[model samples]
Target: MQCPVWIFAACQSLNNWQQEAGSLPKIGVLAIQGDFLEHGKMLDAISMDWQEVRLPDQLDGLDGLIIPGGESTTIVQLMDIYGFRDTIKRRTREGMAVWGTCAGMIVIARKLLDKRPEPLGLMDIEVSRNAFGRQVDSFETEIHVASIPGDPVHAIFIRAPIVTNVGPEVEIIAEVEEGKPVAVRQDRLMATSFHPELTNDTRFHELFCKLSGS
Candidate 1:
């Protein structure tokens, strides 16, 4: 039987990603907190080899690392308990690409409006935690990313943070409001206020893979 148009298109897109990405890089998903399994599934769909990163030691030799969306405070606390802060910084300095989603974005920001969570100060942006209000205010929308071409990316924001201030080196990839940035990238580091793993689209994953030099 012939597949539906949407299914065919999805398969075509996945195949195209596999071809363009060429030799998928070994990626690690921070599994200490949040919806890490969802990120893992997305990686799997793209035929990328990945593992759950709970300890700092597991970061060795990884081409890329993804900090999944979860409670920012809890993720940071677990990172401290597991001694991941310094190691992650070292790895990133060694040219390992990093992507942060939702709460992960807040964890990597240079400055956060909230004082509770001590960010990694990796990305050159100031974030306002829970900028979209409470969980009840969560919503999704289609947005155009500057680097990723074709269709607009489907972004899901759940108590998401917003980039209130961007530094000179940071590149604003996507924005919800005229001046509010929802996604930003700096060198090998990237961050998104929305949860791309929750969506069926794998373009973000593909983009990260390319960024990691897959």
Candidate 2:
């Protein structure tokens, strides 16, 4: 017997809609600290909608989240105080895409080189804070991210963390200085030791948006 063609067509259309609906996925930036406003402006430059996520409730309905660069200890303290640590972990477990930059990378790492507040431990990587040097040592360089198109990306490293090791599941997206990985990805989670929001480029954000289903 021949199946109804209209039913199959309608189902296909519905699937397409579901997929395309996320083309402009709603994103959230952790506004508890760091350059979240810069991230917001970057999102605007890319023509995507984003909000400052200052509370756990703000995490709801977000396709993806960005934790910007800031003082890792203070950020962790605030997250703990506001009960965002566990909430974010749960959301990531449910397949919410997340990207952490600079101090944000440290906050999400699984291991730290120093004794400090516990991070979200969502990314399976070991990090040494300020590996590049102190604030005075901040500098810029161009590196190619395999996932991003076009020319090399201009990376701004300000008191950056260094990824000393990565789990077997992690993928190194970019690196510098004798194969030191600076950007990495594991499933829906991404982390970079440099601040992409500080630049005018949108490739990293665009890549993250794609990961978040945008």
Candidate 3:
């Protein structure tokens, strides 16, 4: 007996009937910080879904998060005001990946050398905030990504942080000519002392997404 066609189809479908978690990972950008819109656009260009995480619920099921570059002090203040610091800590601790670029690095620094107010203290590394001069000293460079496909990435550093001290678990990825650490990765988390979103190149973000498996 052949049984019923629908019954056979259902039997075959049962092996692959699991529901999807929805479109690609919902990347969250801390809107309270600087360059949030810019990063949002980058995400859109890459065809990845993203949202400005201004509330605690926004971080609920994000596959990955981005703390965009901005003023460190003000960014931290907003994080506290919106109660995102605690949520970020919880998510990062539970194996959710995070990428902190420029001022984002300072916000997640566990040990900030500069004499600024406390931060979210997310990463376990020491950072020197705003190593580059103020607005006048802002500069851009083509950074070398060891595993990238083509030429180095064009990174824009506007009052970016300098990773002077990375913990044993942290792996330094890229640096400037002066040996200033620009990119560092600790497990699934990543931090850059520059703003990749501000550049036309998308290597940095692609690399980050690859690492996040999203």
Local accuracy of candidate 3 as per-residue lDDT tens digits, 1-214: 1323423432222222212323345678888768889888766656556788889878888878899888888988878888887889999887777899988888887888865758776777789987887888989878886656566778888877888898889888888977878888888888999888877655566566555553
- Model 3 has an lDDT value of 0.76
Lowest lDDT sum, 10 consecutive residues, model 1, at 1-10
Backbone clash pairs in model 1 (N, Cα, C under 3 Å; residues 3+ apart or in different chains), count: 0
- How far does residue 44 in candidate 3 sit from its true spot (Å)? 0.9
Candidate 2: misplaced stretches above 4 Å?
Answer: 1-22
Q: Would you estimate the TM-scores of all the predictions?
A: 0.91, 0.89, 0.85
lDDT of 1 by residue, 119-206 (tens): 9999999999999899999999999999888899999999999999999999999998666899999999999999999998877887
Which lDDT tens digits does candidate 2 get at residues 167-209?
A: 9999999999989999999999999999988887766887787
- The TM-score measured for candidate 1 stands at 0.91
- TM-score of predicted structure 2: 0.89
* Alpha-carbon RMSD of each model: 2.7, 8.7, 9.6
- Give the number of the best model, judged by TM-score: 1
Q: Model 1: C-alpha RMSD to truth?
A: 2.7
